[model samples]
Target: MTAAASSAGIRLRDHPAFILFWISRVCSALAFQMLGVVVGWLVYSLTGSAAALGLVGLAQFLPILCLTLLVGHVADTFDRRRIVLACQTLSALTVGALALAEGSGHAGLLPIYAAVVTIGASRAFEAPTMAALLPRLVPGEVLPRALAVASSAMQMATIAGPAVGGFAYIFGPAVPLTLAAVCYGVAAVAMAFIRHVHAPGPRSAMTLETLLSGLAFIRRSPVVLGSISLDLFAVLLGGVTALLPIYAGEILHVGTQGLGALRAAPAVGAVLMSIVLVRRPPTRQVGHVMFAAVAVFGLATVVFSLSSSFLLSLGALFVLGAADNVSVVIRSSLVQLSTPDEMRGRVSAVNSLFVGTSNQLGEFESGMVAALIGAVGAGVVGGVGTLMVVALWTRLFPALFHVDAMPVKVETRR
Candidate 1:
C-alpha cells in the first residue's frame, strides 16, 4: 500500500468506536444474509411455488412500510446506540424462534412469515438508527472513506454468509437458522461495546406533520430525491435475486452449493470495488459515475438473465455487483452529507423506505412476473425496464446528473 493509504488505515483502526460499530454491522449483515438463504430455500422447497417466495419478501416489507415514519421519529428522539441494541436483540430472538420451529419439524409457511414480520419490525427501527449514527463515529472529511470501509465489511459478510448457510443445509435446514441466531447474538454484544454517546434530540409530539417531515425534505432536495429514486426504480425493475432458487434448480441445475455461489458472486465483486473506493475515493463527476454504474448494472442483469452456463451467470452477477457498489457508495455519501445533522435520522428513514420498496417490492414484482411468464422472460423484461428507467430518471433529475463531487452542499428548507 502507498504511505498515504497505509496512514489512513492506521487512523481508521485507531478509533475504537468505529471498530466496534464495524464489527456489529458485519455480524448483523452475516446473520441476515444467512437467514435470507435459509428462508428462500425452505419456502421454495416446501411450497414449490414462485409466488410463495414473493410472499416472503412481502412479509418482511409490510412492517417497514407501516412503521418507517414512526421508526424514524424514534431514531431521532432517542439514543441511536440503544435503539440498535434493542433491535439487534429483537432480531436475535426472532431468529432463535425460527430455529426452534425448524428443529421441531413443525415449520410451516405461516409461522415462518410471522417470524419474518418480527424481524422486519426490528430492521425498520435499526436501519435509520445505524445510518444516523455513522457520521458521529468518524470525522466529516473521511466520511466517504468510512462509508466505503463499512460497505466492504458488509459485502465481505454477504460473500461468506450465504456460502456458509448453503453448506450448513447439508447438516439440516435448521442448522443455518441456528447459526444466524448466534451471529445476531454476537452482533448485539458488539453493539453493546460501542461507547459513542449521542445526545437525544428534543422530543416532539407524535403527529402526522412530524412524521411527514422526512418525506417533505426529500421532495424538496432534487439531488437526494433523484439518487434515491433512481436506485428505487432501477433495482425494482432489474432485481432477479428473488428468483435465485428457481435458477439454481430449474435453469442452472446447480443445486444448493451453486445457489450459494450465485448469491455470493455479487458480494465478491462489491467487496473488491469497495476496497478501491476506500483507497482512492471518487473526486469528480460523481453523479455521472453513479448513473453510468447503474446502467452497467442493468446491462449485467440482462446478460445474467440470458446466460444458461454457470460460469457465465456468475460473471454477469459479479459485474452487476461491482456496478451496484459504485452507486451505493456515491448515493449513501450524498444522502448523509447533504442532510443536516438534526435531520439525518428522518432522512435516512426515508432513504430506507426507498430501499425497502426497491428490494422487497421488487422481489414481489419479480415473483409475480416469473409466475406468469417464466424466470427467463421475467429477467429479460425487468432488465429492459431498468434501462428504460435510467433514461427516464436522467431526463427528470438533471441536478443529480450534474453533481461534481462528494459532500455536496444543498439548500434545504426546514
Candidate 2:
C-alpha cells in the first residue's frame, strides 16, 4: 500500500491486516484477563494469604523486567508475528495443562506458580512484539484511530473476561482455565492470519550497548521520556482501583454488585470515548489535550473519593475512563510515530515495561496508603499527586507539552 492510498479519511476496517490485528489483540487480552482471575482465585483459595496473592503479581512482573532488553532485540531482529503466535501458543498449552491439573484435583500451589511464571515469560516476549507489529498493520495517519479502537476492545475484554471467569468457575476451576486456553488458542490463530509489513534493515550482535539502546534513546528524547514518565507517575499515584471494594462496601453502602459496576464504569467511559475519536480524531494541540485528560482523570478520582452517593461515584469513574482513553490514544500514537521502525520493538519494550511497572506498583501503593489513612484519604491524595505530576511535567518537558501535530519522525543512532 502506498502512502497516498492510506491518507486521512481511510478507516482502519478498510485494511485487512488491521482487522486481524485487533481480533488477535482482543482474544489474547481476554485470555490473559481470564487467566488472571482464575489464577488469583486458585492461589488465594489454596493458601488463603494476601501475601501469596502478591506473589502472583511478582511472578508475572519479574520476567518482563529481566527480559525487557533481550526481548526488545528479539522483536527488532526476528519476525514479530511468529514470536507473538509462539508465545500465545505456549500460554494456551500451559493454561490447558492447568485445566487438566485442576480436573484431576492436582492443582497445587507449586504447579500453579510454575504455570503463572511460564505464561508470564511468554507474555514478556509477546507484549512488546505485538505492540511493535501494530504500526505495520495500519498507515501512520490512521494509527491514532487504530490505537483507540484497540484500547476500546481491550477495555471491553477487561470488563467481560473476569465476569466470564467468575461465572465459569461455578462449573469448576478447570472450566475457566479451559475457556482461557480456548481464548489463547483463538488469539494465536488470529495472529497467524495477520500479514503485517516489517522491514528489518540490519541486525547487530548481542552486546551491552545494543541491549541498553532503548533506554539510551528514551533518555535522549525528551518527548519520549516525558510522555512515558508522565504515564508512570500519574497512574502510579492516581490509581484507586484497589480501593474500589472498600468504597463499594463501606462508603457507597453497595455490595459486591455495586463493586462490579464501579469496576466497569471506566471501561464504559473508554469505549464511548473511542467511538468518538474514531468519528472525529484529534486534529491539533494534542499535548495540551492529553495533559487536560490526565487532569480530568485526577479530578474524577478526587470526586469519587469524596462522594457518598453511588450514582455520583459512578459518574466520576465514567468520566475518568473517558479522559484516560484520550491520553492513551494520543500518547501511544506519538511514541510510535516518533521512533524509527528498526528499533520500534526495543522502544516499545521499554514502553511496555513502564506501563506494567506502574500498574503493579499502583495497586500496591493504593493498598498500602489505604491501610494507613483509609481508602477515602488515599484516593484524595492519589488524585492530588496525579495533578502534581501533570503540573511538573509541563515545565519539565516542553516538547511533549507543546506538541501540536500527531506525527514525529525521530532520528536515532546505532
TM-score for every candidate vs. truth? 0.88, 0.95
Encode model 1's per-residue lDDT on 221-308: one tens digit a residue.
9998998999999999999999888999999999988987898899899988888888877869998999999999999999999899
* Candidate 2 per-residue C-alpha lDDT over 113-177 given as tens digits, one digit per residue, 9 for 90 to 100: 99999998999999888888888877787788778777877888989899999999999899999
Give lDDT for model 1.
0.86
Q: Give Cα-based local distance difference scores for all models.
A: 0.86, 0.88
Candidate 2 global Cα RMSD: 3.1
Measured with C-alpha atoms, the lDDT of residue 328 in candidate 1 is 94
